[model samples]
Target: MTHPAVADLIARSNRLGADARNTNYAGGNTSAKATDTDPVTGQDVELLWVKGSGGDLGTLKEAGLAVLRLDRVRALTDVYPGVDREDEMVAAFDYCLHGKGGAAPSIDTAMHGLVDAPHVDHLHPDSGIALATAAEGEALTAECFGDRVVWVPWRRPGFQLGLDIAEIKEQHPQAIGCVLGGHGITAWGDTSEECENNSLEIIRTAEEFIAARTAGEHPFGPVRPGFAALPETERRARAAHLAPVIRGLASTDAPQVGHFTDADVVLDFTAREKLPALAELGTSCPDHFLRTKVKPMVVDLPADAPVEDVVTRLRELHETYRADYAAYYERHATADSPAMRGADPAIVLVPGVGMFSFGKNKQTARVAAEFYINAINVMRGAEAISTYAPIDESEKFRIEYWALEEAKLQRMPKPKALATRVGLVTGGASGIGKAIAERLAAEGACVVVADLNLDAAQEVADGLGGPDVAVAVRADVTDEDDVAALVDAAALAFGGVDLVVNNAGLSISKPLLETTTKDWDLQHDVMARGSFLVAREAARVMVAQDMGGNVVYISSKNSLFAGPNNLAYGSAKADQAHQVRLLAAELGANGIRVNGINPDAVVRGSGIFAGGWGAQRAATYGVPESELGAFYAQRTLLKKEVLPEHVAAAVVALTGPDLTQTTGLHIPVDSGVAAAFLR
Candidate 1:
């Protein structure tokens, strides 16, 4: 059970975090002072409950807070060294734990614990940051809030800054908060309610002051003629084409997932003539630039440019950005500095399209894009009221490569095998397709679930992990246009195509003489032609990405075995079986591995079995409908009934790291049917 004061602090944090205008995702912290019994001494002890390191205030819980003895926390003030060694104080905070160390304390813990108030709120809201980044920020802060909110000059966050703020708090008895110059805002009160109100007052007042003064000023200037966002369809089409190429470049050092945004603020900024100069100045807030990078690589071209020409230029731009970033690292890096993580830019801005942000996974990439937007809001506000002035480049370098920041990165959990992979699974709404989608998602790959049933696909995607791990797209595999669109949707949804599963198929059980032309065409077009179209379209994206990919075809045992009453389906399966070998030999130069799975009569929970094929097969085999699975199992040496999960497991193995050196291989998940084994 949570203490009432702690619960109140959490409620206030969530209220502020939920509103983007109040703060960005994971960009703020809050704290409350409370009393709790000391378990060891059996006496009451004043404790500080502050949001811990790497926690987002919006979703914070009791476990996400650090509980410390207020007396011990304040005692650190006596031993506080200078600002140069302030990072050591963070390590020293472990000794101040009240009981079991709840969570690792953030640097902001000092600011909260050292303050005289019982409640504190520190935020990076755009409105406050705008005022913080303005050239005349200190004076403007005074004009906006008078003595109620004071201004503190830019000082790197550490124990010394905490002391500085504490001194300011002591000096200004009437002040409710202080705006952090070139950073954000901090507020304090005797109660959680008062603290929250003070924080809100700072944000709202800053917003109003900026709004009144910059009412008619066009900070970003007018939109350039050809730089405005293209029509919806045109922009999406362009994005789909360029995303794979951009993702490939961004993943030069490590694989990354991507997120795209065309919000009005982004468009209004990207389309402006002054975008280059403003973007070159970089972001003002540390949280904003930490994810978005020091600056974005601006795509210098018309939105209406030819696709081939645009792709060529994008490659050139990526190369230049990498070189410039490398130079920047060389210019400021000390011997003790952590190695540069990557030279690739996290954010990519195209004049008429929008922004593309990349990270090791989907959520990270989305947050990066959102943070860049916050930076944009800060810039717009600052340029309108005063010249935008962020911290110096050297300061950004110090924070970016700080040993503590590197340690935080190192603390992240090891990625799963399929992390950063985008897999497109056809017929994914049910049966084997759904199983494969879910399995890939479990292994950390982003799955695009495609089926004729949009609602069913969405349900499967939602089950997998919603938009972050999976997305749903309605597609008819037999149609070339739909197959192309499906591949495009995957690239647009999660950067590029890293894996493709040709699982959308059907069967018609009939004697050779009784099989109609339509039956043959349906099976052949869907199983054979559909696989070809999907592979062909996805191959284009893979080659653009320059990243090796996997393509697994769900071939059948009937392809090699002579089964009576099966004509069209068997022939189509044979066509698919051969496709694996042919495509493997052709695509090997491009690092794409083509493989197939042969599963005999997967009747348990199979869509084909439920769609009347089971009855037809049972009648042909002279067995009861319910006994068909057993009959097929009995024919195998192991006598095991192959389920959808078995086939999905096979798909994961072929696409996983273990099978990197194996291609054009067909694995049979048919409970050991020696007759259909690959030679």
Candidate 2:
């Protein structure tokens, strides 16, 4: 059985974490003290449950909370007399864990323990950080909460921080909370509800203050729009010229890089007239240092910059950002500090074009992007009234190099089999294409869901993994322009395309004598011509990237078999098969492999079956449609119905590390079809 107070605390923490506006990603911490009898000694013990490092509070579970013996943690007070206490304090935190092999308590555990309350909420709400990082932060705190809140100067979080918080609490017993300069704000109470309410009240107070200060002000004033206003065709053309170059320069030593264009608050913030000064004001909160560095690197690319010169200009800007970061680190890091890590920019601000976020992989890049968006809004509010005054350079360095964060970095899981790889799946709204998208994403591939139905594609992308792992793009295979933009969208969103699944198709069943030219061309246009356009565009990107890639086409067993009333479908599929082989021959020199899958009897949940074709085929066989799948399953040697997942599995096998040397072959995913077997 769980304690009522602890359960309520967990619920409250989740509520706060669920909103990015309140707590961006995993940047906040919460703690609760509960008394429980130890199962081993049958003695009552005070246990502190705090959000562990790297644990996301939004989806936090009981197991995710770290348990610490309060008395043991309290014993460390005043024990470290030397200047270097971060490493020793971390060791003490480890020794204080009540049970063996649980997650280490958050680095702020000592500070939480020092607060004189059963429930403590420390949050990095943008509103709170906005006010905390402002120039007149202390004066504003006094005005907003009066004597209810105490303002503490910025100290690198460790033993010294805990001691300072304890002294403030002792002196100001009537205050509901205290503000950590350049960090965030913390509120405490006797109950979980009280703690939550206090935090919200404080945030509301800060919001009201900013509102009064910047009554008619805007942070980033208006500026000219660049590629932002271009037509879809031109926008994609610009992205193709810019994204690959940025990815190449960002890669450093890695073979590939991940990137995504963020239109969400990018143009509104980055294109502003005050961007240069506004951007240099520093981070809203020091904790954001983990995801978004101290500040984003701002690159100026005029909207009219020639496509040919964009790459060279981008390269120079990247090097300049790296040099600035190195110098900043050298200026702040002390003699005892660990070796400075690589100075890669986490977020890049383009004045004319929208911002581009980068990471070792797409998911990480998206996380960084989320924080930057939050920062933009927060800083805008702060600058509206008071100039943005964030923590000093020394404080940012301390937080970035804190031992707790370093340990979390070391604990990150090794990349999955398909890490840093990107896959584009056409017709991804349902059936085989959807299955392929899900499978690839599960294996750690960033996916783009392309379909004729824009709404359906968006739904599928959202269900897969939101905009991070998968993005939706509307494309019509027969249109040359749509195909070109589709390829460019994937490349722009995830660095470069590594695997292209040309799986869009529709069947038109008609006898050769009855088939009209329209019917014949529709099937051929979708399967044969669509596959060709996608394959050609993907190969161009893969060749330009100088990295090996896979292009898999979904054909049909009808290509090899003679079937009644399947003239147009069968002929188009046959064309696709030959097209795949030709593509393989041409792209082989560029280290790109092209292959095909011939699937049969995949009736259940298939688009063709759902669109009235299954009943027609069943009526032709003199059986009910419900029995069509089973009847076909019984015809194969294995007596198993071909499933969409099975087809997806075959696609994975070909594109993964196992089939690097084999290409230009059509693998059958159907249970053996005697009529379709090669003669």
Candidate 3:
């Protein structure tokens, strides 16, 4: 049975972790003290439960709580002789575990053990950090919380820090919490509820103080939509021109595949009249160094800058930032420190264009972007109130190089199956295309969602990990220029496209005798020509990169087995299947594989079924439109209707390594269609 206090602590910690404003994805800690029966002593003893390091608080459970005997933890402060005890403390946290079921205790376990209250909570809320790391933070904290909060000077967190906290508690016996200057805040109470409330109260106080102090200032103005140097109509085009350069630079020396995330805020901030002065202010918090790094790399590129100029400037800026970072490390490292990590910048800010955040994979890049966004807000607030003051280079170095902090980075999970690959799916605004895009992203591939409906495509892209993993592009596949641009966009968005899914089509299910030339032309133009255009353009890029690629076409079972009124649709689909085979034959030597998926039914959520043809077919079958899906399911040998996800899975498989030796093939994704089976 779980201890009631530990259970409540997990629930409360989850609530706090769920909100990024209160704590970042895997940052912050919480603890509770409870009495448990000692197995050997047969007596009730004080037990402390603290959140383990690197465990996400939002999904925390009883098993995620590190439990330790209070006496064992308390003894460390007494026996420890000096301050350099990080390695010993880590070992002790694991050795002193009361039970074997939990994770390693957080590095701040000793500090939490010193708090007299039964429940203690530590949070790195942005609002609290904004005030805590300010130049006049000490005075501002005193003004806001008065005697309710005490101030702790910046100290390297470990044994000596815990001792200092214990001494502070003794001096201010009635204090509810204390602010760790240049760090975060800690709150304590007799119960979980009290501790949670105290922490929130401290945050609320900070929020109100910040608002009141900066009421008249407006730091983040709306980003102007167009570039200053380019004509209004060509503003976006110019920005697009720089995308590939930024994406290329980001991928250099990346251990895994790297990509870029774009935003208007980044461009707006970089275009400020005083870019150098504002950007050089350094990170907002010490922990932020892991994401935004010491500072962002700023490049000067006019709105109308040519691609060559943009590339040159970006390369120069990256080199300068790296050189500066190495110097910073040399000035700060001591004899005892580990060698400083890489000097590559995570964020690159381009004037007139937007900001680009880079990572070995999408998620890390997104997190870096999020941190800088918050940093912008906090920096603005600090400057408005007073001067924006954060820890000096020496302090940041200690925290960044700290063994305990470095361990958390080492514990991050390995990348996913398709970690650095990029996938592009046409007609991805809805139906099977959307499913394929989502699935590809889930497998760690950066996806490009191209559709005729630009707005719908953007919406889908925003939902699929935003601009980091997916980008929205409008392409009328039948138009040669549009098709060519779409392929280029995929390369610019995520460095290159390795998976191409040509799935865009319109259905016209009229019988041969009744189908007019107009209807027939539309179906063939979209299904046949569209597929050809996308494939040829995509193949050009793939051949240039010399990297093997996968191309899958979404054909239909109608192509092989004729239906009553599927003449136009089936004929066009048949053309697509043949094109896939030919493309595979021509491109095989270039390390490119092409395949097709033929699916039947799938009446739900598909555009073809939602249109008038499905209603006509349903009426002919003497059934309601909704019943068609069930009818198809029963008609199949497996008694299962093929879903869009089923087709999407096949696409993923074709692009995966399992089919490296196989190509020019057609996979059937329908439940089972005997008539369509290849003999």
Candidate 4:
């Protein structure tokens, strides 16, 4: 008889899968096993139940389950051959399973069988997954789990995976499970309930550890909304195209699929110009490979590309990917290593379109897709801790080509949007903020320049006239109410906000000895606290919109290097810079990008340099106001005063499509001022 708790286990696993789907783009996966003695054969047998392709677990049904003969799977490990024979092995296994009235086995069946337990389950829980993808992930894992768990370095999944796990099991027979490096976890138990409980326990433990170590960590900044809403027909078409691909990759049967029309996280993350570094680290779980490939296939269809051309382009992409895979393998393969598998991509992420995953059955595909989606969120979280450092390129190539890892690739539907998309900037009034806003608009974005100084913002906006346009708004970034209203206005004015330039700030240059408490409060309120308020509102809107976005802070070079006379200004800017780093980590998962721009000696109409040096004071420096510009220029390698336009260019570059994978970075626009100090 089926275990009484099997239903509950399935139900919970499905729910987790669904959560992943809603949160990220094809980001997570789930599986369960049943060990029992066959009544007819009177032999010990294990029935592995994994989620089918194309559907999430939250609403998964029986049709989503892919049943594998565990004993037969275990037998394959003993007679393993090189990677070239993986297809033959899979076909043989499929034939055997078919004879028994079972559907196709999960792509990860071999790895799952290696656990040597009655039931095993895996997932890329957001918190832990994020932690695993960081630069110091291994160290962090050790600090979190201590000796309770064994950390396995990243390895490709499939037959080789089976061998690796078999080896691991031999070394740590009592090990509750393993955390795949640059990936997620695998937990096993004597029963399905035990498996679920153990998975939960492991995740909870990891979460506590991360929270304690990185307290107050958040994403770098706010994301702007782009386009109020996508047409329903477009949304449905995208979903339908994605569903089949996910189902096929996971190797599941019939699967249930769902889509989020107004997902905040999706919009917020997508509106950004780039992906956070954490997302590049690796898949949330090694098992996720069976659904979403290690990396997504980025396609940016042009506006004029016909529908047929788009489809043809997708096919070309698939072909190109295969060729690339072969080349990568040829360049990196060692004599002793097995050849990589050539089929499938676990997940396919198409900007503007959506994401997709494939499986043998709906449940498995859905679970795998969800795992990919959750990884996006987790990667965002990790960005808050530090930039994610996945194994190096050579290592990624090794894993991607590993016969074990290659097994996870699957065919998927195309996503909307191109690999690169347009980005917009706000608060392009004047000063540092205005410069950044202008720079982004100068790039490919259709910029909406908003500021309290409508005329000033409009002037800059008018200068950037094109199909990719720039417009102005009279926004007061310091007012939360105004900030919220600004978001709405931008949504209505521009299709939506893709990039947010939180460059608006105010400062009173005064020594701490003479500064009033009110002055200090004002500094904080405008630069630090005001930035927080704007970011919060932006996040709320961006997350709901389902488009990735970018956020940048126009902090001062004073944030890092303090000049004696500017106490209130320096302190406030310092806080603003810190806040950007924190926000980058928190919002990365939502696919929102955040960063800071620290500029020095930016000469603009705002007049930070109005005090003409008296002839005596000028003689003290041995230079007149007329020569100050030349004097400062002579001090730098670039030999130019920091121009508002130059600083603006840097801001635009940071917020533009070129830097999509960077977040929480502090770029100095000081013409080598900080570098000079180091020298």
- Against the true structure, what is each candidate's TM-score? 0.99, 0.85, 0.74, 0.42
Model 2 Cα shift for residue 348 (angstroms): 1.8
lDDT, candidate 4, 1-679, per-residue tens: 4444457556766655555422233333455556656768887666666554444456666665566666676677666677656645655456434125333455556666667776666666777666667777777777777765677777655567656765776688666776777767777777766776777777778776656655463453443233222454564344433332332222222211221222445434443444433333455454443345556554445323344555556667666656665676677778856656544454554444454544332234445545565656666666666556554556665554555334434444332222122233444666655566555544444566777778887887787663225567777767877776666554433323456666666656555687899988887887788788878876765564445567788787788775655688788898988888899999999888899887765544433443332232234456875566566567667777787777677666776557889999888777777442421
Among all windows of 10 consecutive residues in model 3, the one with the lowest summed lDDT is: 221-230
TM-score order, best first, reads 1, 2, 3, 4
Q: What is the C-alpha RMSD of each candidate to the true structure, in Å?
A: 1.1, 4.1, 6.2, 24.3
* Candidate achieving the largest TM-score: 1
Regions of model 4 farther than 4 Å from truth = 1-9, 21-55, 82-88, 95-101, 213-373, 391-679
| Residue pairs in clash, model 1 | none
Model 2, residue 299: distance off in Å is 2.3
- 163-196: candidate 1 lDDT, tens digit per residue: 9899999999999999998899999999899999
* Best-matching candidate per lDDT: 1
Measured on C-alpha atoms, candidate 3 has an lDDT of 0.78
Candidate 2 — which pairs collide? none
Compared with the true structure, model 4 gives a TM-score of 0.42
